[model samples]
Target: MTWRFALVIQPAGVDDDRRDFSATFRTIDPAEPALSVGELSTQRGDGIFESIGVVDGHPQEVAAHLDRLAHSAEICDLPAPNLEQWRQAVARAAEHGERRGEGVIKLILSRGVEHGPAPTAWVTASAAADFTVPRTQGIRVVTLDRGYASDVPDRAPWLLLGAKTLSYAVNMAAIREAKARGADDAIFVTSDGYVLEAPTASLILKFGDRFTTPAPTGGILRGTTQQSLFDHLREEGYETAEELIPVDLLARADAAWLVSSVRLAAPVTAIDDTRIELDSGLTQAFNRYLLTPRD
Candidate 1:
């Protein structure tokens, strides 16, 4: 699928009103080299990013995404982003892709090269047809070991365990291994045998009218999409809580889902080749609520 992307570099200390699109923002050719050869984000994966879903012509949950991005950047020790500048860039990119239907806007912040004092920032909007089938048909996921104990983040601050940084080689590898094993995705279980999260999404387990997910304090990145879903569920008379989930709870859940910004929510029909309960009715409700604009 063809993608429409916007790449903008706003130098630090620049006023938003004085910025020039012609000079600062470029419509990137996907086939061309987008980053400098010396870029640390490429060389060392030292960056933070956020993927926001764009429906129709508007970016969904932009403020929440930005807040998460800021937190990630802060955790990565990068300079604070100019929210207005990033917002403008995201809008330009999302509009460029909206004509083709829904898409995703990715905001990337990188630690500049060792020789440079400024950071690098860019946004891209890409076609998102990949989620169509999985969202409707549900997905099969396998449980994988994350190799870190549940309480490791509390003891190791420098590990940056909870930050949504660009260093996702392990997460990518986990998903690849799951796909090789005939599953669509993978959920990460802590070394201590607790449910943590998924490679690219958050895990939510449903039992009747109650929903439970891992608390962010357990070193998981705070899930903006999952938070929105929990809020909606609460309003709909469902109970929700953030707690440490045991790996075996998958067998008890009436339904389970992997949720994120672009894909929204995909019900887990099977885990590790074991068939689990599927709640198409609840899954449909989640999709409707997620795709609907909040404001």
Candidate 2:
């Protein structure tokens, strides 16, 4: 896997490095030591992250992602991040990887070391592989129980249900289980049968001319990509909503999708073993909508 580290170089004699803007990039050596054992994020999943889709050097939905990242930090009780620093890093990474046409800019923030007050932050850029098979051909998904009720987030703040934390063991495991079962991905449903979200993406359902997704209060991470697409759809005169949706309703819906930053919008062709209807035209339209540069 090729990786590039974004480096920000301050101008000579610039006391306030925050305002400086010269970006430098270097290839990251995989064999080099990148982290210490004592880092809290390495010792424990004590961090938050954001994966921004980069197209031709520009990061889509920059402000929205930063806002979400800030919200994640607040939820994790970490110090307020230097937003300017993150922006610079992302810009540097994007510039470095622009030649690839499309890629991902990953921003991470950790709670410093095990015994420190500072925080660890960095950005990495890599060319995104074409997931056209899933996006164009659609994907088969299995429904897995998230082992938590829909009301868990409202009742228990310590669980960090709504926050986009770095602890993705369960999510990855669920995907692995699905793959083992001969499926492409997994959709996490609540213990009570409410459809939640995919391991790394949000779920959206379409019925006739209406569109809806699970409410964010249901212990699901608020999806930035979904929200961006929703805004675009609403402006185009489509009926959009966010409400609690039962898993069974997916079978009756006109169509369904698994959307994310990098993957954009992918049609869900099957849930478990049952195949659902796929609107090839609508899916293509959604792909165009999502990939279109947002202003």
Candidate 3:
């Protein structure tokens, strides 16, 4: 998590002109203490964020990430971020880096100090970790009960399920628990035995020639990487779908992957104590497509 560059953003209103908002971005020392002790983002995790993958000097899927950021803001009741301002901010931060092999750009908007004037926003760029082992050799996973039904999102909007909020204590704990249980990652399953998603990635299961991910309806954050892969797969003439996947379906999957912005696509070699075969050719193809620069 070593940041190469950071920028503090004086976020503009949704109606602000791009030319006027460009000056609001200011580069800052990544190691400097820039946050107040009373910031709600640090105190109560009251914020939303998006992470965009960078290849060479290009920021991938900028429009999709910004769209998700706005959606998260709406769900969390934060101010509507001016997309143009954030777009320029992301570009500025990305350009501040070395523009080498792989990197990541993160856009964060917090609720600011507890009773302060306005929200706090910033962007950070960092070199992405080498995921060659996970991408090539694959990873082991375990399923954990998320303590809610698949319909919890519809039944409890206040939970802020689908939004990519900063409140990730539970998600981190889940990953730690998985590691303690002798696995590399964890997949969240509904109390009623339905597949959801990973703590930090989206789940995609393949059955024969068809690929399916859990429907975004079940408190699952819609994955930008998964969507892009789906589009690519469709272009390649492969069948893809989003559906309510049952937990038992994992045992029958021909192949599976956990995809994210930073790590790209990682094959799942085993689930729980059951060994699942890895699709090497497809995995390589997925990573090849993912590593390429895409807007």
Best by TM-score, which number? 3
- TM-score of every prediction relative to native: 0.93, 0.91, 0.98
Compose the digit string of candidate 3's lDDT tens values, residues 48-68. Answer: 999999988788999999999
lDDT tens digits, residues 1-295, model 2?
Answer: 3545544222122133546444432335434676678878878889898999987667888878888888888889987766666776677777666554678888878886788757776667787778798998899999999999887888888888877888888999999999999998999999999989999999999998999999888388889999998998899899999998898888888888999999888898998868878889988988887777764
Query: Evaluated with lDDT, which candidate comes out highest?
Result: 3
Worst 10 residues of 1 by lDDT: 13-22
Clashing pairs in 3: 61-295
Worst ten-residue run, lDDT, model 2? 7-16
Q: Which candidate, 1 or 2, would have the higher lDDT against the true structure?
A: 1
Measured over all alpha carbons after superposition, the RMSD of each candidate to the real structure, in angstroms, is: 2.2, 3.4, 1.3
lDDT of 3: 0.92
Could you arrange the candidates by lDDT from highest to lowest? 3, 1, 2
lDDT of 1 at 115: 83
